[model samples]
Target: MGENINFNIVLFEPEIPQNTGNIGRTCVLTNCKLHLIKPLGFSLDEKQVRRAGLDYWKDVDVEIHESFEELRKKYKDGVFYFCTTKGKKYHTDVKYNRGDFLVFGKESAGLPDEVRNSDPDRCIRVPMINTTDRSLNLSNTVAIIAYEALRQVEFPNMK
Candidate 1:
């Protein structure tokens, strides 16, 4: 059998329940694990999450981390790729593989300086219009990058 592709979608202090829920649904659809850091603006168990994700919540594999350090301790071998508009490298340029973790920050502030600068070598960004000053919606951005990573890993015979 082909090796299982262990993909993880990490949200650092996510701020919106709907966006998180949508990301959760995407994780379920793509067979990727979802990891969320604490201090979320909206409750993960909120009705918004349930409403947005609908029945997809049951299929999604989700892990809640109290802190990045907590998660880092558990997943050492995985590549941590932080997504940011300020990143010098494009997401497409990364040679994504199994056990790669794609991390996104909060909607309002993006990744904190310490976190964004934690591993500059692993930061990735999506190309966007120069005329526009803002990034894509959190859910949309996550779906785009996660699917690309999934595609690169051969989508791994997902069920």
Candidate 2:
């Protein structure tokens, strides 16, 4: 696919059904594609997921990948941005473009050390007052960065 969707939201080994479901809903409302990596914590057909996504869950443009490497190999030329707590820069510091991939991590562990450190410059994070405390919810984190990207591009195809 050549620049089919405005943006891509990739959840790597997401562990929470409700978080994934809420992220799916966000993707639908923002006109972004949702990609779920392998080893999902909950089944897509789970009731909790549908309940969280509400009626719009069926309308979400979602793709399931066996692995992150599979997705990367498929989209070799795609631009990818990693979301991690280890990032030195804020999500707003980057300039997003159409077809860019925003890769998010799982709820508990987050992106692996290798992935997060692979491209330090490409990694970004949301600002928080307390670093030692709990991180933001996975859904909230995705929404924040996705909206920022959408905002940068003036929210194309969205009202």
Candidate 3:
């Protein structure tokens, strides 16, 4: 009945194939785009991904970008919000809508300095429990944020 609200999940040099696969599944279920920035730690067809994502890959709409710069140029006007453990703003507070690009950093180092500092004000994070050394899994975190965004837009039933 109305235009579907689309969100983009950008993975910056993702290290874990399974995590990427899980994120892909989330995108498929939520009706969003998943962007992978190379060079990835493993091939997209790696065993871990196939196992984790099951048979969802066929239906997943995934875009592979050569670099972060490519995504920046393509989505210059869209809001790019980097999700990091060190982000100043909480992910829940950000008003997500259609056309928002939510970017996540690598598994090992999180986001690089250039990316983390590029748009300090837009980066966001999910608040973690106290006394924890690490944050939520990359794919898990994306699911949380992406679903919230989809929910905000009212999850319209598109035929």
TM-score of each: 0.93, 0.96, 0.91
lDDT for 2 in candidate 2 is 28
Write candidate 2's Cα lDDT for 41-90 as tens digits.
98999999999999989999998999888999998888889998878889
**What is the overall TM-score of model 1 with all chains considered together?**
0.93
What lDDT score goes with residue 11 in model 2? 96
lDDT of each: 0.86, 0.90, 0.85
Candidate 1 residue-wise lDDT, 23-117, digit = tens: 99988888788899988888867999988888898778888999988888888766799999889999999998877889999999899888889
User: What ranking emerges by TM-score with the best candidate at the front?
Assistant: 2, 1, 3
Off by over 4 Å in 2: none
Poorest stretch of ten by lDDT in candidate 1? 1-10
Candidate 1, which segments miss by more than 4 Å at Cα?
1-5, 131-133
Which ranges in model 3 have alpha carbons more than 4 Å from their true place? 1-5
lDDT of 1: 0.86
